[model samples]
Target: MTIRRLPQQVADAIAAGEVVERPASALKELIENALDAGSGRLGIEVRGAGRTLIRVVDDGAGIPAEELELAFQRHATSKVRSLADLEAISSLGFRGEALASLAAVADVECRSRGRRIRLLAGEVVESAAAVPVPGTVLEVRDLFANTPARLRFLKSDATELAACLKVVQAYSLLYPEVRFEYTNEGRVGLRTLGRGDATAAAAAVLGTAVAAELLPVEGEGIRGLTSQPRLHRGSRDSLLLAVNRRPIASRALGYAVEECYLGQLERGRYPIAVLELTVPPGELDVNVHPAKREVRFRDERVVFGRLQRAIRAALNGSQPYRMAEALSSAGSAWRTPQVHSAPAFAGLESVVAEAFPAAPGAEGPLRPLGQVQDAYLVAESGEGIVLVDQHAAHERVLYNRFLAQLRAGAGASQALLLPETVELEPAQTAAASDHRDWLAALGFELEEFGPQTVKLRAAPLATPAARAREALSELLQTLAHSLPQAALANAAASLACHSAVRFGDRLEPVEQRRLLEELEQAEESITCPHGRPTRLLLDWSQLKRHFRRNY
Candidate 1:
């Protein structure tokens, strides 16, 4: 093949593919332009999942009449003037490729300042005077019409709509001061009040119930919303981070938030957070991605430290967490208890020493009023009532304490009356020998009796002797497939599980109160080591709904 220069149209199409993959990509570029134009009110409307029409209206500075046609030309930007400007790029959309790329594949109509520019395949079909608005009303129709291959790659309407709304919702958080209205299929999907209130914006997007549980995070160069550890999602989709008003995806950025919640959120569960960071223009780079959704920072360590401290500080004095009760069982009979007519809580000495930083029930926030099925503890809280899972809650309390001990030193061990000899399969025996040090750290005193047998001499602290053999055997089996750190954690969780009191165990009123009190003291008492929630909060409204007490 001979070396040859690609035609301009072919080159433009290739460049367009990088910037405009779908309706959502085009929407993102336009939104960035609106924000950069100093738009205070952004209205976005879409139909057919943005394939038919993607319109964006912003109440910002309109483009000058003379510059209307040039705006669609490649690399023509008012954002940067010199080499120094490019190095310190601040605006969200700067490469000047968005409008050109969009026009390459779609029918674009741009009307601003009494001028009109109609484009198709990156060509100017018409340029004339027209009625103008105060800001920009840029509409893109027949998206990917000429680019049939790109159209084939798009997902269904529902999926694409969700992706587009995700981008809009992210901006809504970054700029709570800017009111936004999103309409899809001739109906309003999301609208946010531009009052600079992140909490209010959260309610609009995440619902009022979740917003009520969110805490305000503030720090140097950042402020946003973060939920309690108990209120978490199965995935990190709910976590949003924006740098300088640009929604970005950086594993390190999300990790910083997760690190602060290490002890609170168990494995596989992620917290919901909206962190907006503002760095000096020179310290951050947003040009790495064509979509402007990923950024690089000069000081990631500084950002990580600041964000972690901000979240922890925000959590200070925020009265612990209580799980929200759901209608899980079909017919679990319960009563609507009166609210807040008694003492909040009474203190108690934790039976398990050094189990938690604060005594769980010391403040008597939720008084243990009674029990249900000898397994669930019913409590009278300040708001309404609380349902505590006796077994799962106890597991959480012990798990955190046990994990902390294992990290501090070799865990405290309780000696057994007589050593129990356990027989393992060949694979399990090999795994046990490989993880022998880890087993010891988990407070297991074991010796290989044979190629397929081992003796369990002592159980980890808090684990009863009766279940010691079972716990050790489970640990060895887990060791076969787990990484070093994960295997240790699994072993600790196994020990905690075997030691926790059973669900059917009968508890006297005094014992119930004691358990509730200790729960309040654990570092993060939301979920057990195995990720099972310990308590369920039945707020006043739920009680009213069931009692038919609606006014």
Candidate 2:
């Protein structure tokens, strides 16, 4: 066989494969085009999970009647003309291949003011005059229809719809001044205000409940929203990040956000945020990927440090953190796990009831005075004072018990009146399936209810009914992102954190004493499962030194 040049249609379809990986990919391109045209209002409608149809109507500058046909040609663009223009590319869709690629594999109908251009297999087959508008109404139908192989790669309606909604939500944060509406199968999923209030838009996109808990963060060139420790998720699914009002994926930015929440939130849980960084166009490169989702920065370390410091300030100012609460005696940082030789009660063959052995005194080491902020238990000791983290103390106690029960192959399983159901993501669902027996061994009686949902009939740990759903979900998410050996510790830590006493809860004197007793009994009473100090000790000598007292 002799080598020959491929047809233009074949090349266009191949390019389409790069930009139109899925429905969300095409939707993102259309959105960028709409934004570049200065659309104040963007309306989107999807059918059959965006495989059958995706229509976008924008109120921006429309194409001229004569240029409608030329718009679909390969490499045709008005955004950039020379190589120098690529350095300072400001527009989102400057590559100009998105439209051509989308048109190559799908039936495209473009409607402008008094003109309609239709394409079939990347060719302009029909051009006619239509009713006029100031913007563009682009309709893409039968996506991957010409390429049946690509059509087969589509996922379930729910999953694909989630993906498309994620794109819309991200862009909504990028341009709060643009009124955005998304309708799936004629049902409106999201609608945002266009008054340039990012807060209101945030509340509309991420439910008013979560939006209310977001902390405002601002730095030299970065400004956006971040969630308080209480308003976090099992995964970074809702972390919306953008640069210059264009949503992009940057691992550095994601890590910077998480680093701010380091000791505040438990392991495996991520904070909710929409961080928008404003950088000079020349300092950033957006041409890394065909979809333009990834970007490169010139001074990443400096920018990352700025983002880290800004978010850390916001988190620190929001409330008193666990580390700060215990820092009086536990040193400047959280407890380090290496301080313990091994798990105090490693194999759990035989249990030690007195985990925190009593000293030679009737009142013992801790004498309860009262609660501080309704969170920590203030106690009097031979030392100046002891501030006991009620949540951390309870967490330490429960973790040892849960792990011991796991070693015993079965702990006391507490059944719920109504079987609680939790819906997992696709990846989590797969992880749960792979480790079903391991979870069962850890005292969880879970069964697959549906493709992506699980039913929890019984739990080993004494978790509340209201928290059972979230507790199990976070545990699975922890296991989903860990290795086999380390995953067990992550799971145990998650269970303890979720089942332990929460901050801001009122505790009676008797309950407080019981918690102290149980916590003392744990082998590793110094630190919680995740290496947070359970109590801080301030001796009399240290207290006296502050007052300049010499004895």
Candidate 3:
């Protein structure tokens, strides 16, 4: 076959693939254009998860009547002029491919300054006079309609809508002065005051309670709101980053923020941060990615170090993280304990024996010696010494038991002495409502208390009161922002992780022995549900070699 150039329609469709990967991506591009057009107030409406409709109305400079048609042409943008201008591009959008991209894959209509233009798959379908509007009113319908393969790849409506809402939330925080009202299926998902206060915007985006606990960050070139060490989430979704008011996703930046929280948060947990950095445009490169959601800095090391120290300084100036606060935050019972001596060895041995009423052959091979740093359980075995991760072992046991209960449809639920109320984020609220029945199967009895709030009357058997609350919160967060296809297993694992004995929990001799027996009975005891090892066995030979006792 001879070499040939692709048709214009085909080329435009291919180009649109990069910019409009999903409903969320399209929304992001539209928002950036509106922001660049000097919009102070924006209204976003979505239906059918942005597949059927996505209407963005902005109170910005509207396109001229004659230029409305030109705006839909490929490579048409007002943000940049020449190649030299790309080096100092301060606007969020410069490529000018958003309109053309939308017109390629979706039916796009734009009404500005009494002129309306419509396109179907990059072809001009309609151009006529319309009602005058204050700013640009752009509507994208039937997204991916022309691309059947792309439409087939979209996720569930709940998942897609959540992604769209997340994009809006990020922008709301990135530009607090821009008032935003977001509606999904006629229900208001978010509304920000946009008074130019980051904390106030945070209150509107991330719940008022969370906003109230955020600490002010004042770095040399970094500023925003960050959560106290006690306030954290199961995922890094809450870590928002913006350089010069342009929101970009950077795992390195996220790590820089989290490094400052080293030894401050538990494993598998991250803090809520909204960091905005002031970097000169000349030192930043935003044209690397087609979507402009990624960028490169001249010196990532300098930025990383500066961000880390600034966050550290902000954290240091605040009161040190309190042990009680950390414990109380997770619903664990971490209070002053009454001092007591260890029970008699014989009594504990008898209790352990009774608890594990199995055949003599089923007895655990390891013998509990004591604990280390009130964390690890040290035990003696025929070969040598074994150090058991008490938490991991307990997690393994609980996960198996929970999975069995779920499969058997007989999950044991314990009634709480006092009902607890939990207020969730917008996405979590939607997730809880969507997966209410699944949560019930996981031994949670929740009632709708109010908007974004739930009343918990019961939890999984043996789960502590506060711990159950924490588990529910984490589960909802995971369900909302994580792998929905594998949610059931993840839910069980989350429950197990929360209900298991904490690392710092001091277990009595009998308790340790009983745990060991149960672990032995578990079908899989080598690793916990999350794949962490439960025990580390140091054989006699290895120990002797380390001690220079080869003989």
**Could you estimate the TM-score for every candidate?**
0.83, 0.63, 0.61
* TM-score for candidate 2: 0.63
Once fitted onto the true fold, the runs of candidate 1 whose alpha carbons sit more than 4 angstroms away are: 262-269, 320-374, 378-386, 422-442, 448-453, 476-491, 505-514, 537-551
Best by lDDT: 3
Q: Which ten residues in a row have the lowest lDDT in candidate 1?
A: 327-336
Question: Which candidate ranks first by TM-score, i.e. highest?
Answer: 1
- Per-residue alpha-carbon lDDT of model 1 for 388-497, expressed as tens digits? 78998788777776677767666678788999999998778888878666667668898778878888888787787888898888767777767764665666676677
Judging by TM-score, tell me the better candidate of 1 and 2.
1
**How well does candidate 3 match the true structure in TM-score terms?**
0.61
Q: What does the lDDT come to for candidate 3?
A: 0.81
Please give, for residues 1-551, the per-residue lDDT of candidate 2 as tens digits: 99998898888898889899999898989999999999999999999899989999999998888888878887888899999998888888888798899899899999997899889889888889998987999999989989889889899988788788878888887788999999999999889988898888887786564566678888878899887664556677667788888887888789888867654455776777889888888998988988888899999988898888888778656642211111112121101112212233333221111122122132246778888898998887764466688998888888888777666666766777899788899878977888776677766889779989989998765777678888888888888898775776677788889988889989999988888778656665655776565775555554454455757
Which is the better candidate, 1 or 2, if ranked by lDDT? 1
RMSD of 2: 17.7
For candidate 2, give the lDDT of residue 310: 84
In model 1, which residue pairs have backbone atoms overlapping below 3 Å?
344-364, 345-364, 346-364, 358-521, 360-517, 360-520, 360-521, 361-517
